[model samples]
Target chain A: MNRQHIWAVLLRNLYLVRRSQYRAFSLFYWATVELFLWGFVTLWLQDISTPDVKITLVATVIGALVFWDLFFRVQQSLTLAFLEDVWSRNMLNVFASPLRPRELVAGYILLSLLFGFISFVFVLVLAFFLYALHIWSLGYYILPFVVNLLFFGWALGFVILGFTIRYGPSVEILAWSLPVLVQPLSAVFYPVSILPPLLQKAAFFIPTMHLFEGMRAVVLEGRFDVGHVVWASLLNVAYFALAIVFFYWMLSLARRRGLLSRLVMD
Target chain B: MQESRLPGSVGIPPILKVTDLAKSYKHLTVVDRISFQVEEGEVVGLLGPNGAGKTTTIHMLLSLVKPSGGSIQIFGQELAKDREGILARMNFAAGYAALPYNLSVYENLNIFSLLYGIPDRRAKIEQLLQEFQLTRFRKQRTGALSSGEQTRVGLAKAFLNDPKLLLLDEPTASLDPSIARDLRALVRNKMRAVQGAILWTSHNMQEIERVCDRIIILKQGRIVAQGTLEQLRRQFEQDDLEEIFVALMALPEPAMEQTERPR
Candidate 1:
């Protein structure tokens, strides 16, 4: 991969965000709103519960929201960065350059990492200041869970990218909706045990499901489960590989069908 | 009439060699076995009506649209295998394709220069801005610029790499006559200086006559005629290039198809 080409794509998107106040503000908008909304819910739940369970309620709920937002934001960062080129009718110029497909993908992934980490930290700080919820209390276990969530988010991001490339912007709703559609299956707000038996079985295939389950194990039982991390990592490996294949397949199909040109013209 | 340099006259291969290139979607054929060449220091105008496959041809050359049959060799490498390597030495500009609207003119050029891997990006950008008369507007957002100014910025970005092969698609369609003339002169000077090749597409016959060393006219995705102005004039018995273009465009489909095949 050409580092210069990758850096060029990343720099191009960064310049867009840097120049526009609305776009810059959007980076933190949803994360902050979700933190506040869920922070209040954590407080209300704590007030109603007995003192013993109150702390558990705060950490579990707030941590889930924070971690879930990481996944969502990373996915959005990638899809939005790509759509920026499409919306500007700049795809032709971009693809016409020496930037390889892999390099372009690398650029989007790096953009997602940059934006995702920034929003993750912003929301973490906001949760601390507003609700006194300490995510760091989850200990070193938080690191693996965070990495697993990022992998799953990237997997989902690539899937959405493939769909957008295949169907054009008409299906951009999938970018916003697909992650939400996977939310229930992921059991972001609840344990897999609370899900129906059928969904529980289906959720086993979702890396986020394994990740959140592991996060709850640490928060509630103080048990750092290595098995959850292993399962999530293995599943992430499969899903991420599949996503990359799907993405390249869709790109080749788009080129053969002249969909790339259509997307530019449209 | 301009003198046409035959390919390989200087013992150098053509910069672009497209052989029997074809693209079809399902049952519909868009580009039908078209073959052409553009030599170094030459400007070849690609003329055709709307949907006559000019844009598709350009897209195929860029590898944005995959060709169903045939090959494209650029800089002595096959485009299918070394797309990135080939594209590094090529650049394209179009009236319809735009830079990111939110970025300033300078930023847009800077980003493209980086994409092209230009070694002296800042210097090249500054020079291109002055060359395109866009120095004062460097800080202005590309979207806020007037259409004509935007076209100039696009041209400047196209030159960022000092590309060996430049593909221009109706580049001056939005420019005023004076600006268009200046752009033609600038392109000619650049070509002469660098020994580069350009495959240009323009509906404006006068501009083509002024800039193009040879003309390839397409009708319904087939090359109906191709030659220097004098040769084309003599073949069609028409003095004006525009008149030749109109007569070729006015031909019925049957006659145009017949022209594509040997009589």
Candidate 2:
């Protein structure tokens, strides 16, 4: 929990983003393209639908997309930060320092918060300027939804990190694809009701599913559902706890197997 | 040939102490029950063939690899319990373990200084840059630098916190001979200035002969021989370290067993 060490890990990754154009582009590129692609799709939906359906469509679809991106970006930030060290063969340098594993994680979490918030705001502004959509219009419930999505994102991030550490860089595809694997189960684009009954039962365990369901309730029904928030929070608590345990377990196993050094050295 | 004081000669604990340290993966023992010490103001070269466990030994010492048996105590504290605190007073550099390539030399050093929590980071970094003759390359990306320059930056980063114990693993492996010689001199000078302990690993017998105050040679995960350069040369009946190393490698396992000397 040394702040200086945590700041160092965070600052090192920040310097990487600040220096490399490709890294900077990758951070914001997909999020921006998603925003624009969905922005126009919502515009087209607005033109086709009646005025009554039009207002809800933009807020529902675009807002969901923005919030989903928040979760994805946060998770990606964590994995990518770690992968940066691995790719540079700098993991030995990092782990050999005074910085603890938890401190390195804290740094990645901070980077996620920074990147997530920036991209969130960036897309929000774009949505506002292009389509006159206001996410804050969803009201104070946005707070809980954002918080739940972020926690779930971090939970998924830890799992991804755990896998990467255990298996090495060969399985890096999981970083890009794991969140997507969770997407359908999360019910990000639609209601859990639309999912098969079996998946709906499975989705109940996913905190993001409840948060997305909760977001729809706020946007469409104008209903403030405390139960959704409570369920999401409880589920997030369990998932996040398990995720941290998994991450540390993998790290301990890696040390025992000499995988940490082998990952960089090989 | 420098004669070295034995560990604990003056009642001060060696900066690094390992007793029966061992690491095994499944059925393979990479580092056998090997024990050694590096006292303050000493440079001990860990020399072995490619798979003789030098890197694994270094990894275990760093706690990057957990030993299956035995203990590592640094600065009189157990490494497992005080890894962060112990590592704060230690640093490592390897040619294969590089600084972030995309970052500039100054940025890399600055970030490492922060990691080590060095006060007066700017002054320390500037001094290292000047000392390593890397001032002109400060703003250049580390990846763009020559192999020798990159090794210098790596060395500068290693010295960032003025670690009490420094572990160098083939740091100049890729550099040209002249650059390697210069780096060897630089490291020796720096260690002397700080009166720090070093556990160095290299295949270059010449480099080890030039830089190491003492040498510990590992063969197949066991310490085959250890003493000053003069002692090893005498024991192996060779004039130069290269010949000594060649003779050691050529011996059968049973013959190698005969050469084992207690530290």
- All candidates: interface RMSD: 0.7, 0.8
lDDT of model 1 at position A217 = 92
Worst 10 residues of 1 chain A by lDDT: A257-266
Regions of model 2 farther than 4 Å from truth = B1-11
lDDT of 2 at B123: 99
- lDDT on C-alpha atoms for all candidate structures: 0.88, 0.88
lDDT, candidate 2, B1-263, per-residue tens:
32232232356789999999998999999898999999888889999999999999998888889999999999999999999889999999998898999999999999999889999999999999999999999999999999889999999999998888999999999999988877777887787777888899999887788778789999889888899888987888899888888888899999988888987
Model 1 has a DockQ score of 0.87
User: What is the C-alpha interface RMSD of model 2?
Assistant: 0.8
- Give the least accurate 10-residue stretch of model 1 chain B, judged by summed lDDT: B1-10
Model 1 per-residue lDDT tens digits across residues A100-176: 88998899889999999999999888888887779888899888888888888888999988988899988889989
lDDT of candidate 2 over A1-266, digit per residue (tens): 89988888888878988898987887778988988898878888889999888879877888889899999999988888988889989998888888888888788889999989988888888878877778887799988899989888899889988988899988889988988889999888678999999999999988888888888898889998898899999999999899999999999999999999766866
Q: lDDT score, residue A204, model 2? A: 90
